[model samples]
Target: MGKNLREPLLKLLIEQKEGYISGEEISQRLICSRTAIWKHINELRSEGYQIEAKPKAGYRLVYRPDRVAPEELIPHLSTTSIGRAVRYQRSVPSTQSLAHEWAKEGAQEGSLYLTEEQTAGRGRMGRIWHSPTHSGIWMSLILRPPIPLNQSPQLTLLTSVAITRALRKQTNLPIQIKWPNDLLIHGKKVCGILTELRGEQDQVHYVVQGIGINVNATESVWPEELRPIATSLAIEGGRTFSRPELIGAICGELETLYDGYLSYGFTPIRILWEEYAGMLGQEVTARTGQGSVKGIAKGLAETGALLLETHTGVQTIFSSDIEW
Candidate 1:
C-alpha cells in the first residue's frame, strides 16, 4: 500500500472498530478510490492487523499488531513533541547509530528511532545488549536541550526516573534505578539507558537517549547465559504488556520530565531519581575507570555525581559501575 493511505486507513478502521467501515466511506474520508482503500487494508493485514472485510459490511479492525510501527504507536501516543516524528524499522544495527545520523542531518528534537531488533545493540562501556525480535523495545530519542556539557549526564538520571515512573504506572511493580541507568526488578536487569551527545566544548548539539526494555520475553526465551542475570516484564510478572503502549508511555513521561528540566532545573528530577534509586544510603562498591570506591551510598550531589562516604572521606564519583 502507498504510505499516504496507510495511516488514514488504519485510523478510520480503528474509529469504526465497534462496527464495519465501508470501503466507500473510507475512500471518501481519505479522498481516495475504493481500490486504494482495499489495497491499504490488505497491507495492514500483512503487517499483522486483523482487519476483517466483507462485501457489504466493509472493513473492521478486529485486532491491531503489537509491533513497533508508527501506524501502531503514533496514533495512540499522547506526547506533544517527543515522538512527533518516528522512524520505525523492522531491524537495524542500533537505534542510537541511526539517531546520530539523523541528528547530524538536523533532525528535530523529539524525533524517535525505533527498531524491532538490533544486531549490534550496545550499553554503557560498550557492553552488548541482547535484543531479540518482537520481544522488546529498542528505541532512541533525540533531544536538543540548552544545557552545559558537564551537566548533560543528568539526562541519564532523569531518563531513569522517567522510565521508572512509566513502568510503575503500567505494571505497578517495584522498579528501581541501579546507579546511573540500569533498571532493576528484584535485582535482575530489565532495562538499560544509554545517553550520547554530539557537539563542541561549550555549546551543545543533540543528545541521543537510547532505551532497551525486556518486555515480553519469558525465562526460556532468554539465552542460557543471560537467564541468570537478566529478566523481562513477563518473566517477573507472569504476564506480558503492549510494547507500543509502553513505548508511548515512556515517551510521554520523558517529555514531561524533560520539559520541566529545561524550564526549572534538575532538582525535581534528581529528587525522584534518588527516591527510586536502588542503593541510596546503603553500602555498595562502585568501580570507576580510575579505581573502585566502597562506601555508603550517600546519594547524589548537586552536579548529579554519586556521593559515596568511605571510611577515609566522602568522594564524588562522576562515573562508575555500581555493585552492592
Candidate 2:
C-alpha cells in the first residue's frame, strides 16, 4: 500500500523536469508519509532511475533508464489504443513471437509486446536483426483491423510511415523509408519492420507488426559485414535518444494514422509515404526469387507493391529486395 504511489510519484517528478519537488509537497500530493515517499524513491533508483534527493530541495529525476517497461512508457503515452497495454520482458527470443500467440488468443488490438533485448530477433525474409541489450527499441504491436486479407499488407506500409514521421520529428534526423519494411539513414539501415498476418481466405484475423529501431546504439554494435550498410540513430545523429519518448511518439503517431485509415482509406497514407519515400525515380535492381529485374525506381502501387519501370514495361513487384 505504501509503495503503490511510486509510479504516480515518478510521473510527478518527470513533470517537474529539471526542477525539484519538495518532499513535503510530494507527501501532500501522494497523501503518504515522507518516509514512504523516500522508500519508493529508492525503489525507483534501484530500477535505474536517477533521483536526486537533497536535504531541503526534495527529489528531482536526474535520469530515467532508456527502458520500455510499462511504468516507464504508459505515463507518457498519449495514445487511446496503441500502447495502452504493454507486456515487457528484460530479454526475449522475439517480441513478434509472443505477439502472434497473444493475437491468436484475441489480445487487444493495441496491445504491445516490448523487450530490452531480443536474442533471436528477426527482420523481413528471416534476416537477423541486431538487437543488443539497451541498444534500440524492440517491440511488436497487435492489430485486428476489419480489412480483407489481400489488403493486410497495407498495414506494413502504414506502420513504416508512422515510424518514419515519428523519428524524424523527434530526432530531427533525416530518416527515410525503404520500400516494404526498412528505414534508412544516409543509405544505411536503421530500422526494420516485419508484419505477419493470420486470417481466412478473404478475411484477416489479425496482424502483428514487429518494429525494431536502432536508437541509442553506437557503430560498435554492428558486425563487421553490416558496418557498411547498417547504422543507429546515435551514430548518425552524433548523440543518443531516449527510447521511452520515442516509443511514446510512435504509438501516438501510429494510433492517429491507424484511426484515420480505418475511417477513411489507404489513399491518404499512401501519399504521405511518398513524401518520405527514399530513392525514388532512381536505377535499382529488384532481386526476387524469380530473378533480378533491373529498372528505374518508380513509386508504390495502389496495393502497396513496388513499381519498377523496366526497359520492356513498368513492372509491379509484390515482394523483392531492391539493390541500389
Give the top-scoring candidate (TM-score): 1
Predicted candidate 1 versus true structure: per-residue lDDT over 72-143, tens digit per residue: 787768999999899989999999999999999999999999999999999999999989999999999999
Model 1 steric clash pairs: none
Candidate 1 off by > 4 Å: none
Whole-model alpha-carbon lDDT for candidate 2: 0.90
TM-score of 1: 0.97
TM-score of each: 0.97, 0.91
lDDT of 2 at 130: 83
**lDDT, candidate 2, 1-324, per-residue tens:** 564586688889999999999999988888898888888888888889999988878888999887778778877699888999778889999999999988888898999999999999998888888899999999999999998888987899999999999999999999998888899999999999999989998888889999999998877877889888989999998898889889999999999999999999899999999999887888988899999999987888888988899999999999888887
Candidate 2 C-alpha RMSD relative to the actual structure: 2.3
Query: Model 2, stretches more than 4 Å misplaced?
Result: 1-4, 16-28, 31-39, 52-60
